[model samples]
Each structure stands twice: as structure tokens, then as C-alpha cells.
Target: MRRAAWGFLTPFLALFALFFVLPLGYALVRSLYAVRRPGLGFGPASVEFAALRNYAAVLADPVFRSALGRIAVLGLVQIPVMLGLAAVLALLLDAGLARAVRWFRLGFFLPYGVPGVIAVLLWANLYVPQVFPLAWTDLLAPPYVLAAIGNIVTWEYVGYNTLILVTALQAVPRSLIEAAAADGAGPWRTAWSVKLPLLRPALVLTATFSIIGTLQLFSEPAVLRTITPAVSAGYTPNLHVYNTIFTDDLPHLGAAQAVLLAAVTFALSIAFLRVTRRWSAA
Candidate 1:
């Protein structure tokens, strides 16, 4: 029976090892080397081991630092706004506020179902200052660009997060809500004191996913860049890597940046898990 089960799993394991692990290993190896073209006549110059040089170079670069800072600011503003809206929407949906709760739920999540590029294109049209005369003058300003991109992310993701929160809220027993109401607790009080605590796991999960997504944010910004000049080639870490690998023709440096980005993401994920675990235990 064990051997039979192993046989069933073998193909999946083999494919995963070949595609995922091998590519990751290759990227790591590539990150350690620089392709050096010594002779000029299209001859092979060979790969030189860079050790920590590429990492140091990437770390020392101001653009990389700025990109990271931009992403940090975007995440700080985006996640809270998105998740807060999601929580409120979830609460409203769960509180049986409207007869069309199912429609509203589907409507909200529908944006996420849209293709990202198409969504950006649609938003890009409305983002025009002329669309809203009051906001016309400030539409394409530098300060508004980050928020524009953030709004795109929020609009795309809030409903999905809401679904997660709502699902978690659904798991809370009706008896608990009834008991709280019997004790003279208001709806808001019940949500704050009773529901939010139990939904903590879902909240943490959504936050973590949002954090990871924010770190690697690219498509919306890339699409928006065509409309807004404020988003440079290296506006975010992932953008930086994309530019380095494809635009600048420096795949090795891009690989190094990718490795560093992964490390940073892993560290932040670990920190998030630790903090949430402590909060849950307490």
C-alpha cells in the first residue's frame, strides 16, 4: 500500500523537483556569478564568481533603496486601507444588512476576477484628471501616483480579503452572537469584542498574503507607468529586478536582486508569523 501511494506521488514529486527546485538552484548559482565578456569578437568570456560583490552592489545602490522605501510606504498605506475596508464589508455582509448580500459579495469580488492589465487600463482611463473636474489639476501629480497605484491594489483585493474575513465570521457560532446580544452588547461591541478576536487567524492570514503581494507588486505599477511618469524603471524591487534582467540585459544582477528580495520577504514573513502567533496565544 505504501509503495503504491509512493508510485502515485512520484510523478508530481519528480516534476516539482525538476521545475521548481532546479530553477531555484540555478538562479542561486547564477546570482553568485557575473558573465564577463573579456574579448570583443562575440567569443565566450566565461562566468566569474562574484561572491558577495553583487549583493553589496545592489544594497549600496540608491535606486534599490528608494524602490524598497517606495514599496514600504505603499504597503503601509495600502494594506490597512484595503483590509479595513474588507473587514467593514465583511461585517456588513455578515450582519445581514441587505437583501442583496449575495449580489454585493459577488460584485465586490468581481474586480479581482478581472484581468490585471485590463483592470489597470480601465482605471487608467478614469484616473484622468478631466474625468473628475475637481481632482483634475492633481491627478497626475507625484504625490498622487503612489495612492493611485495603491487604490488599484485596494480595489482589486479588498473584496477577496472580505470574502476571507466573511468566511471566518461565518464559522463563529450563532449562539455566541445571540449570547452577546442578550447581555446587552451592541452590534459594534459584539464585532469588536467577540467577532474580531475569533477572526484573528483569518485577519493574520489576509495581512500576510497582502504583505507578500505588496512586496512583489509590479503589474499595476508597470501598466500605470505608461500613464504616469512618476513610476520609474526601478520604482519597486520587483520592477528593479525586471529592468535589470530584461531591459538592462544584466540577468546576473537581476538574479542577485531576486535572491535578496526573497530573503527580505522570508524574514518579514517569519516576523509576521511570530507576532501573530504571540497574539493568538495571548
Candidate 2:
């Protein structure tokens, strides 16, 4: 039986090792080395094992630190707002808005189907004063650009999270809802007492996804850079990594920063899951 199970998993294991493990190992190895150019940049570049120097440089960079702080603020604000809207929409659908449910669901999810870059371009037009004349170009300025990006992200993913919550709501036992109704419970009471509790797992799932997505914010700001001076090349951690590798030609430093970002993301996700689990238990 064990042999049969191994046979069934062998192909998947091989692909996982080939794709995930190999690339990660390469990045880790590359991140430990730094490029050295001798004699006023006239000599051949050499690779030197630099230990934690790349990580130290990435941590010391003001641009990278500012970008990290920006996204941290964005996730704190945007995740709650996005998830709240999604929960409301899901509850509305589950509340038996039968006739319009299909149309509403499709409309809400349509943005998710649009390619992210295209969506950013479409939104940029609305934000650019010359294009839309809404006089909202101020929203794309320094103090508000993070919020603008947050708005774009919320619009794109709210529907996706709604669908996830709605699926969880549907899996809820109808008998439980009927019993609540028999007890003279109102819709709000039933949702608060029955549905919301049942929706906890789905909420955690969506929240985790939102956290990861917010941390990896790249496309919208990258696209918006062309239209606004507010967005720097290092507008997000992912953007900073991209700029380091391509724009600055510091692949080792970029790799180190990327690895550190991944570590932070992983730690946060685990912490969130632990907190949610404890809350659910309580």
C-alpha cells in the first residue's frame, strides 16, 4: 500500500522538487554572493561570498524600508475594508436575492477576469486629470497614492473574496438556518448567530490571501508610474526587488531582499492563522 501511494505521488513530488525546490535553492545560493568590480569599474567582475552583506544592504536602504512601511499600512487598512465588503455581498447573496444573484455575481467577478495590468491602465485613466477631468489627480499624489492603490486592489479582489465566502455560506446546513427562523430569529440575528460563525474558516482563507497580495503589490503602482510622479520604482517590496535586479543591476541584493520578504510573509501568514484559530475556538 505504501509503495502504491508513493507511486501515485511520485510525479507530483518530482515536479515540486524541480520547480519549487530547485529555484528556491538557486536563489538562496545566489543571494549569498556579491559582485565585485575592481579598479574604477575597469576590471572583470568577480563573485565573492559575502555572507549577510546583501541582506544588510537591503535592510539599510531607505527606499526599501519606506516601501515596506507603505505596504504594511496598506494591508492594515485595505484588508479589513475589502473583506468587510466581501462578507456583506456574500451574505446578501446567501439571503436569497434569487432573481439577480447570477447577474450580480458575474458583475462583481468581472474585474477579476480582466488582466491586472489592463485594469490598472483603465483605472489610471480615471485618476489622470487630463484624461478624465474629475480633478482627482490629487488622489495620486504622494500622501494618497498608497490609498489609491489600495482602492484599486479592493475593487479587484472584493468579488473574488465574496465568491469564496458565498461558497462557504452555501455549504452551511439548511436545517440550522431553518431552525433559527423557527425560533423567530431575524436575518441579522441568524447571520450573527449562525452564518458568521460558520463562515470563520472562509474568512481566514480570504484574509490570508489578501495579506499576501497586499504585500506583493506591484502591477498597479508599476503601471501608474508612467502617469504620475508619485510612484517611485521602489513603490512596493516586489517593485523594489524588480528595480534592484533590472534597473540597478544588483541581482544578489535583489535576491536577498526577495528572500527576506518571503520570510516575513510566511511568518505573518502563520501568525494570522494561529490568531484566527484561537478566535474560532473561543
Candidate 3:
């Protein structure tokens, strides 16, 4: 049985190291070197070690700083709103408060099935006045673009989060809920006192996933960039990294930025998990 377990684990371990570990290692190494031209116009470019140069440049960039700030704000607002809606919907479905529960479940989760880029484009048409001709307002306008993107994200994932919570709800022993009802506990009272308390673990998991997703905000703004100048090349950190490498032709600096972004994301995720553990303990 031990040998069989090792056999099952070997393939996953190999793939994880090959795909994740190797790429991360390569990016870290790449961030330490730069392409240097020895002469003003005559020499061929060569790789040279300049360990701190790339990282310093990225850190000094105001746009990169703003990109980080933008996502921070977006996550603050969007994560709670998305999770709250998911909790409400999951409770409604679990209690059979709405008709056609099965159909509604499918309908809620369907947006998540659509590819992210396709969903962004579909929403783009609705928000871009040129395409829809009846768009109520310019959601892609500079001041509103971040909120617009948040709406798209919420629409895509709220259903996914709802289903996760719903599965958690199903795992709950039916007898406990029945006992609560027998004691004349109303739906709201039962949810607040019984169901919500039991949902703590699932809620924490979803919130953590939401935090990671918020930092990974790229494709929506990148897609929107094609339609409007509101999304600059450095609109989001990921987008900035992309344009830095491809558009500005600075792969080493891009790699540095990527590494720093990964570090920030990892740090924030760990902090959140630690805070939640403390909450659970208390």
C-alpha cells in the first residue's frame, strides 16, 4: 500500500516541479541579469549581472505602485460583496425558498462556465456605447472602469462561490436544522444562529480564493484596453509586467516585477490565513 501511494504521488510531484518549480526558479535567475550593450551603437548585446538594478527600477515606478493600490482597493470592496451575495443565495436555495431550485442553480453557475475573456468581451459590448447603441452609461470610462471590471468578476464567480457554500450547506446534518425549526426558530434566526456558524470553514476558504483572484486581475482590463484608452499598458500589475516585457522590450525588468508581485501575493495570502486562524481560535 505504501508503494502504491508513492506511485500515485510520483507523477503529480514530477509535474508540479517541472511546471511550477522550474519556471519560478528560472524567473528568479532571470531577474538578476540584464542585456547590456558595450558600445554606443556598434556592440552586440550581452547578458550581465546587475542584481539590484531591475528590482530598484520597478520599485521606483509610480505606475506599478498605483497598479498595486488599484487592486488592493478593488479586492477590499469586491470580495465582501461577492461573498455576501453568495451566502444569501446559497441559504435561499438550501431552504427551498425559491421555486425551480435546480434550474436556478444551473443558471447561477453558468456564467462561470463561459471563458473569462469571452465573458469580458460580452460585457464590453453592453458597456461600450458604440457597440450596444443603448448602453445607459459608459462603464468603460476612466473613473468607472475599475468598478465595471469588478462587476464582471462578481458575475462570473458569485455563482461558483454560491455552489461551494451550497455544498457546505448540504454537508450539515439535517437533524440539527430540523431541531432548530422544531424549537420554532424562524428561517432568519436559524441561518444566523445555526447555518452561518457552521459555514465558517467554507466561508474562509472562499474568501482566501477571492483574495488570490483579486491579485490576479489581468485579463478583464487587458481585454478592455483594446476598446478604450482608459486601460493603460500599466493598468494592473500583471498587465504592466506583460507590457514591460513585450511592449517595452525589457524582459529582465519584467521578470523582476513578476517576482515581486508573486512575493506580495504570497505575503498577503499568508497574513489573511493567519488572521483567520486567530479568529477561529478566539
Candidate 4:
């Protein structure tokens, strides 16, 4: 039976190896070797390796460094804001306040179902400097634009995170809450002393997911570029890699940047796992 199961999965494994693993291996190898074109730069024999020059150039490039820094800042800002709002919304949704629970739950979760590219496009139309009601084009333009972008991200993801936290909240036994209330605890006290602590695992899990997602944020900024001239080609790390590979024909550098981004994400995930382990132990 196990052999049959393995046989059934063989095709999927083979496809994964061919499409994903092989390309990743090729990109890693190519990242260390810059291509050089000889003669008129037109033909086959022209392409040759230039050693680790690509990796060195990518590491030394100011634009690449700036893109990384900008992304780090974006992550720092976005993750906390998104998670906090999600936590609050989750609490509200789980409170069972009224007969409108279904409507509120659906409304909150609706944005998560929207594709990221579509959400960005929707924001683009609304955030137009002249058409926008937020005064994004006036003297207070900078803050307005920042707030607008942040709002779009928060709006899109908060509902998803809320659902996660709400589900976690639901897993908490009702007996604990009743016990707390019997002991003279108020609703806020019960939530703070009983609910929040139990939701720690869920919060950490959501935060780690948010970190990974924020690090890879591309479509939102990319779509915004059509409406806002301030968002440049290298505005984000992913954007930098995209521009390098396709716009400038710097495939080697692009691969290097991608590898580095993947490494950072892996490290972040590992660190998050360690923290979760500690929390679980405590």
C-alpha cells in the first residue's frame, strides 16, 4: 500500500524537481558567474563566465543596498501594524456581540480574497493625487501618500490575520472564561488574563507569516508605480531583482539578490521557530 502511495506521488515529485529544484540550482550556479559577450555581442561563443564578479558587484552596488534597507524599513513598519490591527479585529469578531456576526465576519474577511495585484490596482485608482480625498498631492503629500499605502496593506491582510487569531481564540475552552468570571473577573479582565495568553502561539505564527509576506512584497509597489512616479524601479528588494534581470539584463546580479533574499527569509523563519519553541517550553 505504501509503495502504491509513493508511486502515485512520483509524478508530482518529478515535476517539482524539474521545474523548481533544477531552476533554483541553475540560478545559484549562474549567480557566481557573470556572462561576457565577445565580438559584436550577437552570437553563441560570446557568452563566458566572469568568475564571482556578479556577486561582488551586487554586494557593492549602492542601489541594491538601498533597496534592501528600504524593504527592511517597510517590514518593520508593516508587520507590527498589520498584526496589531488583526489582533483587535479578531477579538471583536470572537466576542459574539450581536446577530450581525456573520455579516461582520464576511466583511472583514472579504479583502483577503481579493488578489494582491487587484487590491493594488484598486488603491491606485483611489489614491490618485487629484482624485484622492486624502490630500496626497498637497503640501502634506508625503505623509498622506505613506498613510495611503499603509492603509491598503492593512486593509487587505488584517482580515486574514483576524480569522487566524479568532480561530485560535475559539480553541480556548469556555470553562476557563466561566471560571475567571466566577472569580470576580470582568470581561476585560477575563480576556486579558485568560484569552490573550492562550493566543500567544497564534500571534507568533501570524507574525512569522507576516514577516515572510512583507519581505516578498512586490505586486503592490509594482502596481503603484503606474500611478506614482516616486516609486522607482529599485523601490523594493524584489523590484530591484526584477529590474536587474529583465530591464538591465543583469541576470547574474538578479540571481545573487534573489539568493540573498531567500537566505534572509530562511533565517527569519528559523529564528521565529526558535522563539516559538521557547514560548512553548515556558
Candidate 5:
């Protein structure tokens, strides 16, 4: 039976190894090397093992540090706000608000169906003073661009998260809800005492996704970069890596930064899962 199971999984395992493991291994190997040019850039460039020099340089970079700080703040503010909105919407839908659950769900989820680049472009117009008469130009400024990007992310994913929560709510045993009602729990009390707790796993899932998405934020800012000076080539870590590869002509350095970012993201995800596990256990 175990051999049969392995046979059944072989194709997927092979594909995973080919697509995910192989590329990751290649990137890791590339990140340890630096391209060295001869004096006056006259000879063939050679790849030299850089050890941790590339990583050290990336960490010491002020732009990269600022990008990290910016995303951290964005995640802190955006994740809660997005999840809160999603939870409320899910609760309302589950409660059969106005008896139009299907329509409401579709309406809420419509933004997520829109292509991310198009959504960013649409929002960029609203932020760019030259394009819209009522534009909030201040929000497009350097100091507030992070928040603006957060708002865009929240808008895009809130509905998707709402759907996840709603599905979780749907899976709650009907008898538990009936018992709550029999014990004199009103809608609000039932939702507070029963439904919310049941939805914890869904909440954690959405939060984890939001954390990963926030760290990997790229498209929205990339789209906005052309329209506003607020977003520079190195506005985000992903953007920094992109600029290093394309604009600065340092693919090895860019690969190192990309690897470092992935490492940080992995560490954060592990920490979050550990905390959530403890919380759930308690």
C-alpha cells in the first residue's frame, strides 16, 4: 500500500522537484558567487565565490533596509485592517444579510478577479493629481506611498479572505449553532462566542497569506513607479532585486538579495506559525 501510494505521488513529486526544488537550488548556488571583471572591464567576466559578501552588502544597503522597514509597517497596519474587514463581511454574509448572499459575495470578490496590474493602474489614477481632479496627491508622496500600496493590497485581497472565512463559517456544525441559540445566545453573542472561535484557523490562514503577500509586494508598486516619483527602482526588496538585475547590471548581487529576502520571509512564516500554534494549543 505504501509503495502504491508512492507510485501515485511520483508524478507530482517529480514535477515539484523539477519546478520548485531545482530552481531554488540553482538560485542558492548563484547567490554565493560574484561576477568579477578584469581591470578597466577589458577581459572576460569571471564568477568568483563571494561567500557572504553579497548578503552583507545587501544588509548594509540603506535602501534595502528602508524597504524592509516600510514593508514591516505596511504589514502591521494592512493585515489587521484587511482581515477585520474580511471577517466582518464574512460574518455578515454567513448571517444571510438582506437575503442576497450570492450577489454580495460576487460583488465583494469582483475586485480580486481584476488583474493586479490593471487594479494598480486604476488606483494610480485616483492617486495621481494630474489624472484626477479629486486625487489625494498627498497620499502618493514618498512618506505615504507605503500606506497607499497597503490600501491597494487590502482592497485586492479582502474579498478573497472574506470568501475563505465564509467557507470556514459554513463548515461549522449546524447543531453547535442551534445549541447556542437554544441557550439564549443572540446573533451577536453567537457570532462572538461561537462562530469567531471556529473561524480561527481560517483567520490564521488569511493572516499568513497576507504576511507573505506583503513581503512579496511587487506588481502594484512596479505599476505605480512609472507614474510617481514616490516609488523608486528600489522601492521594495523585490523591486531592489529587479533594479539590481536589470538596471544596475548585477545579477549575482540581485540573486543574493532575493535569497536573503526569501530567508527572512521563511523565518517570519515559521515564527508566525509557532506563535499561532502556541496560541491555538493554549
Candidate 6:
């Protein structure tokens, strides 16, 4: 049995190292090296190990710092709203309070099936005045653009989170629920007092996933960038890194920024998990 299990895992472990680990290691090594032109732009540029030069450059850039701050604000506002809506929908479905439960569930989850870029393109058209002509307001305006992107993200992932919560709800022991009922707990009280407590783990999962996704925000704003001037090349950290390497021809700086972004994501996720776990245990 052990031999068979190792054999089964070997293929997955090899692929994981090849596709994920190797590239990550390469990026880390490359980030420590930089491309430099020597002596009045008269010689061939060369890549040389510059230690923390790339990292320092990335850190000192105000544009990159602003990009990080932008996504921070977006996540703070969007994550809670999205997860709350998902929790409500999951609770409604679980309680059998809504009509056409199967259809409603499918409808809720359908947006997540749409490709991210495609969703952005669709929303871009809707936001464009010439395309859809909403005379009342402009979602693509500078002040509203971040919120607009947040709405797209919320639409795409709310269903996914809803399914997570719904699955968690299903695993809840019916005997516990019946006991709550016997204790004179109403449906609302039972859900608030019982089901919500049981969902802490799932909530933490969604929160961490959402946090990572928020930090790596790219698609929605990137697609909308073509339609709106509000989104700059440095609108989000991932997008900023993309523009840095491709647009500015600074792959070393991009690699450094990418590494830093990954590190930040990892640290934030770990910190959040520790705090949530402590709270849950309490």
C-alpha cells in the first residue's frame, strides 16, 4: 500500500516542482541580478548580480507603493461585502426558504464559470458611454473605477464562496440543530448562534483566498484600462509588475517586485490565519 501510494504521488510531485517550484526559484535568483548599460550607452548591456539593487528600486518607487495601497483599499471594502452576501445566500439555500433552490444555486454560481477577462470585457462595454449610454452616471470615472472593479470581483467569486459556505452548512450535524430547536432556538437564532459558529473555518478559508486574490488583482483593471483612463499601468501591483517588465523593459525590477508581492501575500495569509485561529479557539 505504501509503495502504491508513493507511485501515485510521484507524478503529481514531479509536475508540481517542474511547473511551480522551479519557476519560483528561477524568479528569486533572477531578481538578485540586474541589467545594466555601461559607459555612456556605448556598449552591450549585461546582466550582473547586483544584490538588493532591484529590490531597493522597487521599494523606492512611489507608483508601486501607490499600487499596493490601491489594492489594500479595494480588498478592505470588497472582501467583507462579498463574503457577507455569500453567507446570506448559503444560509437561505440551506434553510430551504427560497423557491427553486437548485436553479437559484446554479444561477448564483454561474458568474464564476465565466472567464475573468471575458467578464471584464463585458463590464467594460456596459461602463462605456458610447456602448451602453448610462446617462445617469459613469462607473469608469476616476473616483468610481476601483469600486467598479471590486464589483466585478465580487460578482465572480461570491458564488464560489457561497458554495464553500453551503458545503460547510451541509456537514453540520442535524442532531445538534434539533437540540438547538428543542432548546427553543428559532431559525434565525439557531443560524446566528449555531451555524455561524460552525462556519468559522470556511470563512477563514475564503478570507485568506480572497486576500491573496486581492493582492494579485490584475484582470479586471487590466481589461478596463483599455476603456478607461482611470486605470494606469501601475493601478495594481500585479498589473504594475506586468507593465514594468513588458512596457518598461525592466524584467529584473519586475522579478524583484513579484518576489516581494509573493512574500507579502504569504506573510499576510499566515498572520491572518494565526489571528483567526486564535479567535476561533477563544
Model 6 / residue 155 / CA error / Å: 0.5
TM-score of model 5 vs. true structure: 0.94
Per-residue lDDT of 205 in model 1:
94
Greater TM-score among 4 and 6 belongs to: 6
Q: For each candidate, what is the lDDT?
A: 0.89, 0.90, 0.93, 0.80, 0.89, 0.93
Q: What clash count does candidate 1 reach?
A: 0
Two-way lDDT contest, 1 vs 6, winner = 6
TM-scores of the models, in the given order?
A: 0.91, 0.94, 0.94, 0.85, 0.94, 0.94
- Alpha-carbon RMSD of each model: 2.7, 1.9, 1.8, 3.3, 1.7, 1.8
Worst 10 residues of 6 by lDDT: 128-137
Residues 1-282 of candidate 2: C-alpha lDDT, one tens digit per residue:
999999999999999999877877888899999999899988899999999999999889999999899899999999999999999999999998556898989998998988888988887767667878775556788888888888889889999999999999999999999999999999999999999989988999999988888888888989888878999999899999999999999999999998888888989999999998898788
Off by over 4 Å in 6: 1-12, 128-135
Worst 10 residues of 2 by lDDT: 130-139
Question: Model 2 segments beyond 4 Å from truth?
Answer: 1-15, 129-137
Clash numbers, per candidate: 0, 0, 0, 0, 0, 0
- Ranked by lDDT from best down, the candidates are 3, 6, 2, 5, 1, 4
Off by over 4 Å in 1: 1-20, 39-44
Model 4: weakest 10-residue lDDT segment is 138-147
Q: Compose the digit string of candidate 5's lDDT tens values, residues 142-184.
A: 8878888988998899999999999999999999999999999
- lDDT score of residue 49 within candidate 6: 94
Model 6, 1-282: lDDT tens digits are 999999999999999999978987888999999988888867799999999999999999999999999999999999999999999999999988999988988999999999999999888777766778672468889988998899999999999999999999999999989999999999999899999999989999999999999999998888888888999999999999999999999898899999999999999999999999899788
Clashing pairs in 5: none
* Residue clash pairs of candidate 6: none
Query: What residue runs in model 4 are displaced by over 4 Å at the alpha carbon?
Result: 1-20, 39-45, 136-147, 279-282
Query: Per-residue lDDT of 55-137 in model 4, one digit per residue for the tens?
Result: 77878988878877876777788788899888777777776754687788788899999998899877777666576777445
